[model samples]
Target: MSLRDRLFGRERRSAQTARKRLQLVLIHDRAGLSPGTLDALKDDLVAAISRHVDIDASGVHVTLRSDRDKQRLVADIPLAPSRERRRELG
Candidate 1:
Protein backbone atom coordinates (compact mmCIF):
# COMPACT_ATOMS: atom_id res chain seq x y z
CA MET A 1 0.00 0.00 0.00
CA SER A 2 1.13 3.53 -0.62
CA LEU A 3 2.07 5.69 2.39
CA ARG A 4 -0.92 7.87 1.67
CA ASP A 5 -3.32 4.90 1.69
CA ARG A 6 -1.86 3.67 4.96
CA LEU A 7 -2.12 7.06 6.60
CA PHE A 8 -5.71 7.40 5.43
CA GLY A 9 -6.54 3.98 7.00
CA ARG A 10 -7.63 2.42 3.75
CA GLU A 11 -8.26 -0.93 5.49
CA ARG A 12 -5.18 -2.78 6.66
CA ARG A 13 -4.80 -6.24 5.11
CA SER A 14 -5.10 -8.07 8.44
CA ALA A 15 -8.30 -6.27 9.40
CA GLN A 16 -9.85 -6.92 6.01
CA THR A 17 -9.03 -10.64 6.14
CA ALA A 18 -10.40 -11.01 9.63
CA ARG A 19 -13.61 -9.25 8.72
CA LYS A 20 -14.13 -11.63 5.79
CA ARG A 21 -13.49 -14.69 7.93
CA LEU A 22 -15.83 -13.51 10.65
CA GLN A 23 -18.62 -12.86 8.19
CA LEU A 24 -18.32 -16.30 6.61
CA VAL A 25 -18.23 -17.98 9.98
CA LEU A 26 -21.43 -16.29 10.96
CA ILE A 27 -23.32 -17.40 7.86
CA HIS A 28 -22.07 -20.96 7.94
CA ASP A 29 -22.86 -21.21 11.61
CA ARG A 30 -26.43 -20.27 10.86
CA ALA A 31 -27.47 -21.27 7.34
CA GLY A 32 -25.43 -24.45 7.08
CA LEU A 33 -25.26 -24.42 3.29
CA SER A 34 -23.60 -27.38 1.70
CA PRO A 35 -20.07 -27.01 0.38
CA GLY A 36 -21.09 -27.38 -3.27
CA THR A 37 -23.84 -24.80 -2.96
CA LEU A 38 -21.58 -22.44 -1.11
CA ASP A 39 -18.96 -22.65 -3.78
CA ALA A 40 -21.48 -21.94 -6.50
CA LEU A 41 -22.84 -19.02 -4.55
CA LYS A 42 -19.40 -17.55 -4.12
CA ASP A 43 -18.68 -17.84 -7.81
CA ASP A 44 -21.99 -16.21 -8.71
CA LEU A 45 -21.38 -13.49 -6.20
CA VAL A 46 -17.95 -12.71 -7.62
CA ALA A 47 -19.42 -12.61 -11.10
CA ALA A 48 -22.15 -10.24 -9.96
CA ILE A 49 -19.84 -7.93 -8.09
CA SER A 50 -17.34 -7.84 -10.91
CA ARG A 51 -19.98 -6.50 -13.24
CA HIS A 52 -20.03 -3.30 -11.19
CA VAL A 53 -16.41 -2.85 -10.15
CA ASP A 54 -12.96 -4.14 -10.83
CA ILE A 55 -11.80 -6.69 -8.23
CA ASP A 56 -8.71 -8.68 -7.40
CA ALA A 57 -9.66 -12.14 -8.61
CA SER A 58 -7.13 -14.04 -6.53
CA GLY A 59 -8.05 -12.14 -3.40
CA VAL A 60 -11.77 -12.72 -3.46
CA HIS A 61 -13.05 -14.40 -0.32
CA VAL A 62 -16.66 -15.30 0.38
CA THR A 63 -17.96 -16.98 3.50
CA LEU A 64 -20.75 -17.22 6.02
CA ARG A 65 -20.31 -16.43 9.71
CA SER A 66 -22.32 -16.42 12.90
CA ASP A 67 -22.27 -14.51 16.17
CA ARG A 68 -24.65 -15.62 18.92
CA ASP A 69 -28.15 -15.43 17.45
CA LYS A 70 -27.08 -13.46 14.43
CA GLN A 71 -25.60 -14.67 11.17
CA ARG A 72 -24.53 -13.03 7.91
CA LEU A 73 -22.78 -13.66 4.63
CA VAL A 74 -19.47 -11.94 4.12
CA ALA A 75 -17.67 -11.38 0.87
CA ASP A 76 -14.20 -9.87 0.85
CA ILE A 77 -13.65 -8.55 -2.64
CA PRO A 78 -10.49 -6.53 -3.00
CA LEU A 79 -11.29 -3.85 -5.53
CA ALA A 80 -9.16 -2.15 -8.12
CA PRO A 81 -9.37 1.54 -7.38
CA SER A 82 -11.48 3.79 -9.58
CA ARG A 83 -12.20 1.11 -12.12
CA GLU A 84 -15.42 -0.44 -13.37
CA ARG A 85 -15.30 -3.89 -14.87
CA ARG A 86 -17.96 -4.68 -17.41
CA ARG A 87 -18.11 -8.37 -16.60
CA GLU A 88 -16.47 -11.09 -14.57
CA LEU A 89 -14.57 -13.91 -16.16
CA GLY A 90 -16.08 -17.21 -15.13
Candidate 2:
Protein backbone atom coordinates (compact mmCIF):
# COMPACT_ATOMS: atom_id res chain seq x y z
CA MET A 1 0.00 0.00 0.00
CA SER A 2 1.03 3.64 -0.50
CA LEU A 3 1.77 6.16 2.29
CA ARG A 4 -1.34 8.22 1.41
CA ASP A 5 -3.62 5.14 1.57
CA ARG A 6 -2.31 4.15 5.00
CA LEU A 7 -2.86 7.66 6.35
CA PHE A 8 -6.41 7.72 5.00
CA GLY A 9 -7.14 4.35 6.58
CA ARG A 10 -5.93 5.56 9.99
CA GLU A 11 -8.16 8.64 9.73
CA ARG A 12 -11.21 6.54 8.92
CA ARG A 13 -10.59 4.23 11.86
CA SER A 14 -10.22 7.16 14.25
CA ALA A 15 -13.45 8.72 13.02
CA GLN A 16 -15.41 5.50 13.51
CA THR A 17 -14.06 4.99 17.03
CA ALA A 18 -14.89 8.55 18.05
CA ARG A 19 -18.44 8.27 16.70
CA LYS A 20 -19.08 5.07 18.65
CA ARG A 21 -17.84 6.56 21.91
CA LEU A 22 -19.98 9.67 21.42
CA GLN A 23 -23.10 7.58 20.81
CA LEU A 24 -22.61 5.62 24.06
CA VAL A 25 -22.21 8.79 26.07
CA LEU A 26 -25.20 10.47 24.45
CA ILE A 27 -27.47 7.47 25.10
CA HIS A 28 -26.75 7.60 28.82
CA ASP A 29 -27.24 11.35 28.92
CA ARG A 30 -30.55 11.36 27.09
CA ALA A 31 -32.16 8.43 28.90
CA GLY A 32 -30.61 9.01 32.32
CA LEU A 33 -30.43 5.24 32.56
CA SER A 34 -27.23 3.40 33.30
CA PRO A 35 -26.68 -0.15 32.16
CA GLY A 36 -27.37 -1.56 35.63
CA THR A 37 -30.59 0.42 35.99
CA LEU A 38 -31.95 -0.79 32.67
CA ASP A 39 -31.39 -4.40 33.70
CA ALA A 40 -33.22 -3.89 36.98
CA LEU A 41 -36.07 -2.14 35.19
CA LYS A 42 -36.53 -5.06 32.82
CA ASP A 43 -36.70 -7.50 35.69
CA ASP A 44 -39.20 -5.41 37.60
CA LEU A 45 -41.44 -4.92 34.56
CA VAL A 46 -41.53 -8.64 33.85
CA ALA A 47 -42.40 -9.47 37.44
CA ALA A 48 -45.20 -6.93 37.51
CA ILE A 49 -46.80 -8.27 34.35
CA SER A 50 -46.42 -11.88 35.39
CA ARG A 51 -48.51 -11.16 38.49
CA HIS A 52 -51.65 -10.36 36.46
CA VAL A 53 -51.56 -12.66 33.43
CA ASP A 54 -49.77 -15.35 31.51
CA ILE A 55 -46.94 -13.94 29.46
CA ASP A 56 -43.87 -15.24 27.73
CA ALA A 57 -41.14 -13.41 29.61
CA SER A 58 -38.65 -14.38 26.97
CA GLY A 59 -40.66 -12.47 24.36
CA VAL A 60 -40.88 -9.23 26.27
CA HIS A 61 -39.21 -6.32 24.49
CA VAL A 62 -38.14 -3.06 26.10
CA THR A 63 -36.01 -0.31 24.77
CA LEU A 64 -35.51 3.41 24.64
CA ARG A 65 -36.64 5.07 21.44
CA SER A 66 -36.02 8.63 20.35
CA ASP A 67 -37.65 11.00 17.91
CA ARG A 68 -35.96 14.02 16.43
CA ASP A 69 -36.07 15.79 19.78
CA LYS A 70 -38.05 13.54 22.09
CA GLN A 71 -37.08 10.38 23.89
CA ARG A 72 -39.45 7.71 25.18
CA LEU A 73 -39.25 4.25 26.69
CA VAL A 74 -41.18 1.69 24.66
CA ALA A 75 -42.16 -1.74 25.89
CA ASP A 76 -44.00 -4.42 23.99
CA ILE A 77 -45.64 -6.62 26.62
CA PRO A 78 -47.35 -9.63 25.16
CA LEU A 79 -50.30 -11.22 26.91
CA ALA A 80 -52.36 -14.29 26.15
CA PRO A 81 -55.66 -13.45 24.47
CA SER A 82 -58.80 -14.42 26.28
CA ARG A 83 -61.84 -15.81 24.49
CA GLU A 84 -63.89 -12.88 25.69
CA ARG A 85 -61.71 -10.43 23.76
CA ARG A 86 -62.30 -12.33 20.56
CA ARG A 87 -66.08 -12.00 20.92
CA GLU A 88 -66.13 -8.33 21.93
CA LEU A 89 -65.79 -5.41 19.56
CA GLY A 90 -65.77 -2.75 22.26
Candidate 3:
Protein backbone atom coordinates (compact mmCIF):
# COMPACT_ATOMS: atom_id res chain seq x y z
CA MET A 1 0.00 0.00 0.00
CA SER A 2 0.95 3.67 -0.36
CA LEU A 3 2.36 5.83 2.50
CA ARG A 4 -0.96 7.62 3.00
CA ASP A 5 -2.86 4.34 3.16
CA ARG A 6 -0.35 2.91 5.66
CA LEU A 7 -0.55 6.01 7.85
CA PHE A 8 -4.36 5.95 7.77
CA GLY A 9 -4.37 2.30 8.77
CA ARG A 10 -2.20 3.05 11.81
CA GLU A 11 -3.66 6.19 13.32
CA ARG A 12 -1.75 6.17 16.61
CA ARG A 13 1.70 5.86 15.03
CA SER A 14 0.88 8.56 12.49
CA ALA A 15 -0.44 10.90 15.13
CA GLN A 16 2.52 10.31 17.44
CA THR A 17 5.04 10.96 14.66
CA ALA A 18 3.21 14.13 13.61
CA ARG A 19 3.13 15.48 17.15
CA LYS A 20 6.80 14.64 17.74
CA ARG A 21 7.92 16.28 14.50
CA LEU A 22 5.75 19.35 15.08
CA GLN A 23 7.19 19.88 18.54
CA LEU A 24 10.75 19.33 17.28
CA VAL A 25 10.35 21.72 14.34
CA LEU A 26 8.61 24.38 16.44
CA ILE A 27 11.35 24.20 19.11
CA HIS A 28 14.07 24.42 16.45
CA ASP A 29 12.43 27.42 14.78
CA ARG A 30 11.63 29.18 18.04
CA ALA A 31 15.02 28.84 19.72
CA GLY A 32 17.17 28.23 16.63
CA LEU A 33 18.21 24.99 18.29
CA SER A 34 18.48 21.77 16.34
CA PRO A 35 17.93 18.40 18.06
CA GLY A 36 21.69 17.91 18.47
CA THR A 37 22.23 21.48 19.70
CA LEU A 38 19.31 21.26 22.07
CA ASP A 39 20.74 18.06 23.57
CA ALA A 40 24.10 19.72 24.15
CA LEU A 41 22.42 22.78 25.64
CA LYS A 42 20.31 20.63 27.94
CA ASP A 43 23.43 18.86 29.26
CA ASP A 44 25.24 22.14 29.80
CA LEU A 45 22.24 23.74 31.46
CA VAL A 46 21.85 20.94 33.99
CA ALA A 47 25.54 20.95 34.81
CA ALA A 48 25.81 24.74 35.09
CA ILE A 49 22.75 25.19 37.28
CA SER A 50 23.71 22.32 39.58
CA ARG A 51 26.75 24.31 40.69
CA HIS A 52 24.51 26.90 42.41
CA VAL A 53 21.22 25.29 43.30
CA ASP A 54 19.91 21.82 44.02
CA ILE A 55 17.59 20.82 41.21
CA ASP A 56 15.26 17.93 40.58
CA ALA A 57 17.54 17.22 37.63
CA SER A 58 15.56 14.23 36.45
CA GLY A 59 12.33 16.23 36.26
CA VAL A 60 13.82 19.43 34.84
CA HIS A 61 12.13 20.60 31.66
CA VAL A 62 13.89 22.69 29.05
CA THR A 63 12.00 23.92 26.04
CA LEU A 64 11.69 26.76 23.60
CA ARG A 65 8.81 29.16 24.27
CA SER A 66 7.39 31.63 21.80
CA ASP A 67 4.91 34.45 22.35
CA ARG A 68 4.00 36.93 19.63
CA ASP A 69 7.39 37.83 18.07
CA LYS A 70 9.44 36.89 21.09
CA GLN A 71 11.27 33.59 21.58
CA ARG A 72 12.94 32.43 24.79
CA LEU A 73 14.54 29.32 26.24
CA VAL A 74 12.18 28.36 29.03
CA ALA A 75 13.75 26.16 31.66
CA ASP A 76 11.23 24.79 34.12
CA ILE A 77 13.93 23.49 36.44
CA PRO A 78 12.26 22.19 39.58
CA LEU A 79 14.21 22.85 42.77
CA ALA A 80 13.68 22.70 46.51
CA PRO A 81 13.90 26.21 47.94
CA SER A 82 16.25 25.88 50.93
CA ARG A 83 13.82 23.95 53.19
CA GLU A 84 10.23 23.24 52.16
CA ARG A 85 8.85 21.66 49.01
CA ARG A 86 6.86 23.72 46.47
CA ARG A 87 3.45 22.25 47.36
CA GLU A 88 4.04 23.09 51.03
CA LEU A 89 5.76 26.47 50.58
CA GLY A 90 3.41 27.79 47.92
What does candidate 1's lDDT look like per residue over 1-90, in tens digits?
A: 888988998857887899887776656656978557788988898888889877787788876666687666778888875523334431
Write model 3 residue lDDT over 2-87, tens digit each, in one string: 79867788545677889988976886876768867777888899999999998778887777776677778888888846655755
Assess each prediction's global lDDT (C-alpha) against the native: 0.75, 0.78, 0.78
| Model 3 TM | 0.59
TM-score of each: 0.54, 0.61, 0.59
Candidate 1 deviant stretches above 4 angstroms: 1-29, 81-90
Clash count list over all predictions = 12, 0, 0
- Predict model 1's lDDT versus the native: 0.75
Model 1 root mean square deviation, Cα atoms? 11.4
